[model samples]
Target chain A: MTRHMSESDSDRSPDAAGRSWHDMGGLPAGGINPAEHDFALWEKRVDALQVLCATKGLYTVDGLRRALEEMGPQAFESMTYYERWISAVTKNLLETGVFTTEELNARMEAVAARGATYGDASIEGASPEGET
Target chain B: MTSLPHVDPPAFPPPYPSAAPRFAPGDAVRVATGHAPGHIRTPWYLRGRVGRVERICGDFANPEELAFHRSGLPPRALYRVRFTMKEIWGERAERGEDTLDAEIFEHWLEAAEG
Candidate 1:
């Protein structure tokens, strides 16, 4: 936007320019129509996880932002906001040595075996262990 | 006693003595064109843009370092810099008079010159 900008920034289309993927402040995009939304139970859980993790000194909020940025632009375009957040939070927890990869994968498998839908799986202790 | 379980060792950031403010309110400054990759609080659009220091937002832990689990020691001064829409969008600005404010850490700023 100024003379100080590099030729790469001025020469190419904003998308192709050597620009940080997340830096789209002045780029042409869709109209903004602000709207209120009711939080889903899962989304609230994600939020709570972030807050709890921060309070526990496991990671800073900035650490969570780093994880989100690391997910890349494809994930940004595809994943819902809270979905990205949960993914990021999970990653930071893993990085901090809170749990091992094998532990996480095994837990994920156990959870997946619980039921076909998230709602069915969420019912505490409802899983018929090793049904799969 | 046997080692306890279920308690996670806290990863708290080490306390850092704060740095003094370099620029004062109403001083002119420019945002640094920092391209380092990591979790950055400064937005890309504001890079190389010149603005006026609207106010001092006090010192805070450096988020860039904090993001990597490092102690953000020697806290930096935070400032609310004000930029005109025209400066950011050129002639495409809907109104040149409109302004945007960003909270920037001291390290991202430099003395502005004509």
Candidate 2:
């Protein structure tokens, strides 16, 4: 199959896409297709951040920014995907009214100190009762 | 207090014809639309779940701008519905600990008898 670069290809190049995946030393791109690997990684990162937000109650914009930064380079370049994932999680957090911005920030700082590092965490905790 | 001149209340505007109420606070529903190319607030877990609506938040409001996208109109009336975590994870939810909230589009729901 001939690889044809589209008009927008210049803006969305593989190099741009690879910035995140490259942190893991270029996952089997030749054999397994790096873009697919990056997407999978991106999906997993989203799941991890969702748990962090729900359990730790880190649902503010600043809190999300901190979580993304903690995600390191691999999850950073896939920022667009990260934003979408957080938006979904934030909507739920707001609807449930579990934690406020101040509480979330404090939780983030505490989680950061625990050396939680990068990985998915379970959102197993008390469910927030509906308010408003 | 001095009495003011009586003024007729501003003419009430005609009420919009309400859309047919499909799902209620405890009805199962599923998303009819697939993942589009642009920004969307719906999550992957509630794509095909038979969950219950917890609250009906009216009208679309852009969630991205509220978070980070900083663009797009406010999302339409969003519904905060509850789904058994078991419905989403199938056995993942422990006994008596099974529920999740999904911010779903109004068009994405249909009544399902429990």
DockQ (Cα-based) for each candidate: 0.27, 0.03
lDDT of 1 by residue, A23-121 (tens): 666677888769989777678778988899899999998898888878888996799999899898889989899999999999989988877676433
* Tens digit of per-residue lDDT, candidate 2, span A56-109: 643544345433434556554565665656655755575456667788788878
* Residue A97 error, candidate 2, Å: 36
Model 1 chain A lDDT-worst window of ten? A4-13
Candidate 1 per-residue lDDT over residues B13-61, each given as its tens digit: 2133235778866677888877677788888777777787776777788
- Worst 10 contiguous positions by lDDT, candidate 2 chain B: B1-10
The predictions' CA RMSDs to the true structure, in order, are: 12.4, 19.8
Chain B TM-score of every predicted model? 0.82, 0.59
Assess each prediction's global lDDT (C-alpha) against the native.
Answer: 0.75, 0.49
After superposing candidate 1 on the true structure, give the runs of residues whose Cα lies further than 4 Å from its correct spot: A1-13, A16-18, A32-37, A118-132, B1-19
Model 2, B1-114: lDDT tens per residue?
111111222243213322444544545565543443223345433454566666555564445343443433534456667765445444333642445566776766766655
| Best DockQ among the predictions, by candidate number | 1
Q: For each predicted model, how many residue pairs clash, with residues at least 3 apart or on different chains?
A: 0, 13
Docking class of 1: acceptable
